[model samples]
Target: MEVKDKIVIVTGAGSGIGRATAIHFAKFGATVVVSDINTESAQKVVDEIISNKGKAIVNKCNVAKFEEVENLVNSTVNEFGKLDVIVNNAGIGPNLLRTHESRLKDWDAVIAVNQTGVFYCMKVALQQFLEQGYGNIVNIASLAGLKASPNNISYSASKFAVVGMTKSAAMEYATKNIRVNAVCPGYTESALLNQLIGAKPEMDAILKSVIPMKRYGKAEEIADAVVWLASDNTRFITGQTITLDGGTSL
Candidate 1:
């Protein structure tokens, strides 16, 4: 997928799937805006991209905040003149607990960042896209969004919202040259997964055993799907969720 000269924005580009996706976009010749709440981590990614002769810039943003999300999209356009695509990769996972045992604070936290954050970013970006007459969005949802996530109610709910919003927006602007899609990664080797493994060491084996591939997916693997969905190669594909679960969901 050639995205040369395209201007792209990747939220939570400081780590994991977000980091990988930002790097991939830069490698493919997109002028990437590496956005993260952690400016330090974001700068490191920008430095690496610059060192490799790739184009990128750091834009600190807390996606949970509407003002920051607005500024993220606005600042990118202000700096780059236009935005071609946005990868809504910034999201937080929840503590593993049954619904009744789960903390309300945890649910709120997850919804704020994962669900509302995606909506905030999409809302601002859609405005810009409408003005420009064309744009693309690739939301990094989770396989949990597509199926039952037993103990992780909040995360599942937030991601499900992302999937719904993606589809709704895709159909709403289908004829307007705006494409919206989501990537649902299952048991990926991400910081979120590491946290889970840290809490329950046996989860690593348990998770892998359920997947047909019998392995945890690499962040780069998920990034590849994000890149493809954002590229012109999938120009006609929208309102879709590409699940990368190694058949675990089946």
Candidate 2:
């Protein structure tokens, strides 16, 4: 369970689940690279980790952009010497209306951040892993990926792509000492959801009724699963997705 001295990168480490994961890994003694588009938000977590005597740094990056992602890995290795794990946790929800009704601008934003962003992070990380001889990858997909949320075409499609990428990449490098996997969460209680609920509580209730557990998920719970996947304890496991849905997919 000890990842002491291991350098791990967490995208979207500004808030919500990403922030939680960054803090959790730092507490576990990992040298954390906290990456986010907003330096202000990311620095807050880095400040907290440093205050507690954990190793961390804030990297202002937008994963969708290749230049930023490349710089992110390079800076981490420059500062920490090597990278052992990466959490492709940066993603955006569907901000569009419907698939057909989606504006080009909205669709482009979602695809770039959610789908392409995962590819960018993994591609760079895998190259580092090849040189280092071992690596661990944890991708954040969603229950929307499995359930086909028609109303949220952009999000569902991006998450589904994440699942596909994790499995395919895992197979390609399974013998090369790289472990790739995805974590699919249900309607977790997060800042994004709170905003959504505030805008449309009635619609939220309708969606909540679909969950058997009938409640929101906490960020810490998801952090636990992500940590386990990155640890040596799950070495034999790869190309698999662990769902955190409240039996909603069942």
Candidate 3:
């Protein structure tokens, strides 16, 4: 759908891909709701959007909490009059740990945020879409969801679940005009990847070497793809994971 003047919601928009996606949507004339766990960060993004002559609002939400997600959707509709699109981009990655070394706490935390959080967002957004007869969802999954990441088993598992959720939800709502899709970014330059590289400095070179492009993907590049997918031009597309990795998976 055309994004101009559409009411959009972007979660985990305090930093990284979420932030970029929120700003990009606003730049395209969408009235964006900048939802993030951090209040200050969310407000900052809202301020940035307003400074650039774009429309935005801040909503502090911890996606792991179902109640908070429900409130987010309710409040968005209350303030904007309707909901058009939602980007379930809020996710967390546990530190790199092998499957055997992984702790239950770490695994649960990752799943709660990355997988279950997306489910909650999708569920609430779909409800509103059903009420309004249309909506769009772009979930930020990961390249790890497609291929095994040896050191980060928890994150991979959770993302894989997100990919599945996206497909299942899309199929169920395809005839209802509610489109659900996913964006799988590989080793993009973001706080998450920087943290991973910080822990294993040697892996930085290894990561770049594996990518045929020999470079890390940019947050804006991924953001561009997200906004495009959220547009009306892709009404025929749903339940697909658009991988943004630089040929690393190949």
Best by TM-score: 1
* Best-to-worst ranking by lDDT: 1, 3, 2
78-180: candidate 2 lDDT, tens digit per residue: 8878899999999877663767788888778988999999999999999999998999999999987777687687888889999999999999999998999
The residue pairs found clashing in candidate 1 are: none
Candidate with the greatest lDDT versus the true structure: 1
lDDT per residue (tens digit) for residues 37-135 in model 1: 999999999999999999999999999999999999999999989999999999998799999999989999999999999999999999999999999
**Candidate 3 residues 135-220, lDDT tens each?**
99999999999998888888999899989999999999999999999999998989998888888899899999999999999999
* Local distance difference test scores for all models: 0.95, 0.90, 0.93
How do the predictions measure up, each by TM-score? 0.99, 0.97, 0.98
lDDT of 2 at 130: 95
Locate the minimum summed-lDDT window of 10 residues in model 3.
91-100
Total clashes in model 1, counting residue pairs 3 or more apart in sequence or in different chains? 0
Candidate 3 residue 138 Cα shift, in angstroms, is: 0.4
Off by over 4 Å in 3: none
Clashing pairs in 2: none
